[model samples]
Target: MTAPAPASSAPVPAAARHAAPPARAHAGAPRWARPGFWAVLALAAVLYTWALGSNGHANDYYAAAILSGTRSWKAFFFGALDAGSFITVDKPPLALWVMGLSARVFGFGTWSMLLPQAAAGVAAVAAVHSAVRRSLPGTAGHAAALVAALVMTLTPITVAINRDNNPDTVLVLLLVLAGWLCLEAVRDGRTRTLVASAVMVGLAFNTKMLQAYLVVPALALVYLAAAPGTVPRRFGRLLAAGAALVASSGWWMLVVDLWPAADRPYIGGSTDNSVWDLVVGYNGLGRIFGGSGRGGGGGGFGGESGAERLFNDVMAGQISWLLPFAVLALVCGLVLATGRARPVAAPPSAEAPVGAPPPAREDSGARRDLPGARAALLLWGGWLAVHYAVFSFSSGTFHPYYTTAMAPAVAALTGLGGVLMWRAHRRARAWAWALPAGIAVTGAWAFTVLRRTPEFVPWLAWAVAAASAAAAVGLVAARIGPRVRLRIAAAALATGLAAGLAGPAAYALTPLGSPVNGTNPTAGPAGSGGFGGMRGAGGTPDGTRGGLSGGTRPEPSEGTPGRPAQGTPGQAPQDAAGAGTRPEGMRGGPGGAMSEQLIAYLKANRGGAAWLLAVGGAQSASSVILSTGLPVIAMGGFTGSDPAMTVERLQGLVSAGELRYVMPGGGRGGPGGGSGGSEVDAWVQANCAAVDPAEYGGQDSAQDGAQDSARDGARSSLYRCG
Candidate 1:
């Protein structure tokens, strides 16, 4: 509904410069009234938001943080992990802000907390659809929009994150929204839309730190080159947008840093109390290069895999299905769909044949010859390439699920190229050949990708390859032979697309069919499975993690692959991933249905201290805290490694009679948790009496039923302290 953008080389219109594009206006138009649009949205909403309450508190760490945040504005604003504000979650507070507000309004529970992510998922799908429609033209544009939206929505990793309370969900939405705004800026030659685009990126930064900025380079390039302006003017406008970006993302970081440290939670991921340290050291480069920079305490991606991890067994199934196709699309679109000679204008009295296709989209190959289209190329292609390269090359600690960021960029390029090539094919031009080439390339690549999961769909890959080969053959025959009907080529292309889409569609549907629980959850034919379940596939020792080079396996219970260590009966070490700990909420950690006896024991002995008991980290404490509404300090935050309370500080809490009992499950490098709780854990072991959890009727309750965190829960152990 935006005012028709003038010629790409023309001067900007004043009215177009002020108003935002009416992207949402399309929802009410006749085009939307058609069945296809509604069908896509309806299916997306069902997949994203249905059966919302099943995940419980999704990830215990963030769920506990939400409980703390809702208690007061300070905790909410600071991303505190508890009401006492012991220490904040490692990242910024924007994601917690949305989740905490939902928990506050709806009253904290699994469903209320996860609702935001589901809503975000739907919004992301709609936003991508809108972006495609606005950037491409014609019915091909609408068709591409549907395909792109579905491709992104059904991506296994996107589906996995969107179904939980993960910050990645919000981050993905914000990034795609920026891409849409940038597209509008180019179309209208409006600097204001560019401002909006920058604002969105800044907000994304608040959601996930430097990871959100991966696409910023492409955004700047697109706006400067494609936006209606002289070179100097475009540069000036981009400078202003950059200023806006810095101001928006920096405000929260400044507030957190400038706030008196003693009055708030310690910044958990940092070795120092400084928030900027947490950003630049841990969440930023430290993720790529490992070793939390100047901040003590170690970090790294582990092993020498580097960028090869992207296509490895762990990640390939989740985010890579469409990656090959996207790359192919971008190259084809750039070379085949650019620089077409402008068609000679037809006379006013001339009428085209009834069966002839309509003129190409207004922004299709002819207009794409303008600088703006080339800028679009840089925006989308750059987004995909930068993220892929960084994710592949970074030596810092990374998770399999982080691929959520790449989904939108890949989806956009796929849609753009598909529409252009489809339009280009009608003209019988040399570039039109890119269509068949694309089909063949994607089909061959897909066959290889599918080989990794042969057990999943034994014959499905062959079917896809055969259908795609046929489509390519049909299209070429239509081009070279007089008797071949073009309709045959169209049907063949449809069959190929449907065939190509089947594997990922099945993968995405996995989570919907089964309960997903773990940090790096993946979707497959049967259902969702944790990253732990998939790890033994990559040449690592089976059922155990290989140690650093020049080392034998870690000491049993010392930094185990999943749990940090094992303690006495009823005890397992906390999750040990440290500041890089992938918080899986209730679904992660050594989870179990804590015994009723343990709950009663804490309640009966609550008189001496403000907390019933303090444990190693969120994993060891979340279920108890949630079930009993009692204060249990998760001292290490997510991984027990956050120096949240030094040994001296904890001793002070005990001396003041503000804390009493200590849980026995926490320790250094010994199973499930990070390393921050060692001093106190050691102090308890040396000074306190061992309290047999069995005496309290906590007697191996879940141990008898099941030992896994996903089903029953982790073992529990307790210590008596004075």
Candidate 2:
């Protein structure tokens, strides 16, 4: 028609001139997008809440605390091991507060106790979706946001932890909220918004102490670099936000510290009954340096410390399925999505002379998207990097469940990277190879993870490999097949998504098939032992797996295997090996039959005593308290190792008639040592009368060598003290 245009004079598309397009307003997005977001959340809710009660009193250590909290506001505030408030749990009580409030309102039962975490999981998925959608607006943003939410919802560890009672569930939600708030501050340039973001992190700190700070560097750096303000103003606002962070995180710690030691419960996991010591020595540097937690046993749980630790047998099933793909996305997104903003032309105005070049307005329209895309890449990429570094190599107690903290970052980057690569593929750019590369790596990794549990859905690994290969090939074919590009792209996306998600989706569904281990929740087949085979191969009698001990049947202390140790009736009664009221399904408790008898005996005989029984550790005391809702003092705390009770303290309780019964091995015996010893054991042996095991329907295990074994075994006979 008109003269053909020269190569140099061809009209440039708006996208070619700008690094990224501005986000479209939420109201302008397709109506289907809103419904799709809610659908993702609904899916998460169903996944988290289904068959939750199968995990009865999940992590009864914390479950016991929740019950105690329901009975005593003091216990609720302090996260006490028993209603008597003798000692606090090792962790802070923010999570307890949420579960406690729910229990209080709904009545403390399995459903009420676990529902909060399930709700928190859905909220976390929602937070991730919102963060991604708002940061990357328009059609692409919607796709990325939905994909991110779906990935998070299907993450194996994310599903397992949310259904259980761990504090990590709430901690993950709070951290995500903080990330979103930080993003909002960057978009709006508001100091108040930034302060709110810091407050969220502080709350997360209270949830899990130092673990919550993992995302702080990313949150602060993103704002400092990309927020709409001068460098000094951003720094000043950050200072103010930092002050807010300190205030919110410290108020509870300060209150607990200032309260008179005699008036409040003893701080658990501390060498000297100080919360500060627990924070600094046990939960802090001790976790990273090793040998700082209770009994100096912080030598990192799960597996060996190295860059590949996340892929180890103990952890790979829980989190590694998507890890390689997330890493690839992070690298490709950072490299391909970054570019200088082009000077966009403004629409001609009335005052501008005819043919005058429109004033070159920089950072308009798509140009603004460059900083946002890069900022998002940095925020999520840094989150994944920092957590990966810490969890993979930190020489502390590294439970597989701890990987839930990485889920959001992994989900976000996968969505972000997939969407960015798809955009490149559509344009037939050099970076189009990213999509195929991501699919291939993710498929291979998923196959590898599935092979670890070969018996579990054995066909799934081959299916994933096939889908990934087909998808990668289709993506390559789309480059030259212009007439069929749309069909190929859609098929490739479906196959790639199926390949990427199949392994995690199968793992995520495993929790529903059986009750996951309460103490260390791992998402796999029933006998997967927990992270690194921490649980015994077959699991425990009550279905709760033991920590470090693996829930193996205890070797007989006397008589013969599988029989209670026999001894003189009046001698300090020996452990029946694994006997006790299985008050709940917590590992290291007396067998359910034995514990019922024991709880019944204590309830009947606990007249006028301030405490119904005093046991060696929180493990045993938690079992007893959960059974009766009565005060049972945990003598030494978590491992029977915190030195919460001494000979003098036990004597004072006996002399005051506040404590009447004593059992030594509540949890792995609080024996004599440089670290808080069993002087209380000696005191009780001297001043207390051993009740005959026959008196309470208990087997007589008090044979030769029984006393020594009693300190480490699950069940010990009752002793009566005036």
Candidate 3:
């Protein structure tokens, strides 16, 4: 087979380039065609919001922070886990700000907190469609755009994350929007448009910090290489964009870092209580280079670091369904666009001297016909490559769902590749085989992913294999006859799409069957293993399924620091938020309630205390705060690793009558040794009396051998300090 031609790296002169022919008039198209876009959006909305309330404060960790923010503007701004502003959640508060405003207006229910993420997910689909359609013109472009939107809407991980309140949902939307805006700027070489793209990236930074910058290289590469400008002009505009990026991303960090530490919440996940440390240390470098307290929990998640990490048993099912096809599209699109172009003379510009020939036109035919296609390929292709490398090899805490960032790129490329290869098929060129090849690879990958959970839907793998084989054969046979080619190719393409999409579509639908785990959200059947080989059922050890299932959520324990949360098989879940009776036959619910007896006792005995109770980590504190809409301090932040509180501080709170109850290890995270953990534990043990378990429905906690009567996972024991 002949090798595909190499892509040209040199820029096309601005004057020589001609716009691609206009796409079919979308307005003139049949009415049925117009609703296709809205239908995809509506499907996305239903997928994201269907039974959203059943999630019930999904990822109680962020839910608590949102709840706290609703009550205290200070807590809201800082992303604090408690309204008293003890310590903020690990990341920046922009996502919290979005959710908090919704909660404030709508009354802090599951719907209010999660609806923002759902909306972002829908907007992201629209952005992906618009970007892809704008990048690839004409009828093919419209079809590709729809395909991209559908793939994005149905990606398993996208579905799972969109239904929850993680900051990543907002992060994905902003980054995709940035890509769209960057494409828009490329069309007109508008500095404002480019800066707007940068601004989106900056806001994305505030959503998830450095993760947002991963697309920066792609954006800059496309604009600097393909935009209509001289080299120096492009460089200067990029500089201006760089300044906008820094300003937008750093404003919040600057404000938080400069705020007096005593007045605001302690920056969570940082050793020094500084947002800069959280950025440059934990969330930034710590992610690239593993460290002890840098939010990695000692680097165990996303499988081993290698090229195959994404396709590994732990992660393949989340984002790899269309990855292989995307790779093929990227290479083919760039090469074909470049190789087919032939320079030709153009009309003289106003600046040209009297009879000067159109200064040797540099780009022609294919490139001129589809100007934005190559640029789009560069943006999405580069995005996929950079993220794949980082997520595959990064030493820090990696979760399967982090791959959601890769979804839009993969989706766009799939659409582009399908259209590009189908066009080649019509010409019956050597590249025509790519369409069949892509189908085979995708179907095989889907089979492999489905086989990983063989029992989930037993026939899925076989069905995918059969469809792929038939489609590949049908496409190949279409070459034998002109009369049947068109009809044969269309049917085969649809079949191939069904084969490629089956696995992810199944996985995406799994979340609707069972509630997604808010903390470690993964999409698959109940027992399908995800990251770290944990069951998809909320990471429970004893086989109970559901995000808020009893015995799954991490409970405070005397276990070693950094130990993952564990649950016994038969115990009722105490920390599940929004626990209540579901409509008969409904599959999802927290399944249990916060100990009302314990909540009442704390409320009655508060006695002017500033905090209702103190728990070792966010998990324990979150439940109480969510239940009562009151301040319940999370001593060590998300993982009980941050040095948010000292022994002296605990003593002061107790001494001032501002605090009375302390529940050591009340969350999945144990007390942080760096935060006066041992000394604090000793003071509580020696100076405080163990409250009787009978007073609060036998849920009182015991530490240091003080009447061990705690029940419901032994997490609710409290120490009464006077």
Can you write out model 3's per-residue Cα lDDT over 527-566, one digit (the tens) per residue? Answer: 4434322244222334334332333433222211111123
Q: In model 2, where do residues sit more than 4 Å from their true spots?
A: 1-25, 292-300, 342-367, 526-594, 673-676, 699-717
**Candidate 3: segments with Cα more than 4 A from true spot:** 1-32, 342-367, 527-594, 667-676, 699-708, 712-717
26 in model 3: Cα distance from truth in Å?
2.6
Q: Each candidate's lDDT (Cα)?
A: 0.66, 0.74, 0.76
What TM-score quantifies how close candidate 3 is to the native fold? 0.86
The sequence of per-residue lDDT tens digits that candidate 1 reaches over residues 215-274 is 898888877656765779888878888998998888988988899887888887777877
Q: How accurate is candidate 3 locally (lDDT)?
A: 0.76
Q: Give lDDT: candidate 2, residue 526.
A: 38
Least accurate 10 contiguous residues by lDDT in model 3: 555-564
Residues 1-722, model 2: lDDT tens digits: 35434569677653234223346547579777888998999989988988675455667688788888988899999888888899999899999899999988866666778889999999999999988887676887888899999999998888888988889999999999999888878777789999999999999999988889999999999888778767899999999999999998888899999999888999988888888888887777767766634424533456788898888777787788888888888787776566554687788877766787887785432335656677787899888889988887777676788889999999999888778778767764576688888899889888887777676667889999999999998988888767988799889988999889988887777666444466677776434535323222223333333444444323323222112133321111213322112322234232221245556677788888989888767766776665566777877777567888777878888889888888765455445421146576676777789887556655446552343233323355468898
Worst 10 residues of 1 by lDDT: 576-585
TM-score of each: 0.82, 0.86, 0.86
Model 1 score (lDDT): 0.66
The Cα error of candidate 1 at residue 693, in Å, is 3.9
Q: lDDT for model 2, please.
A: 0.74
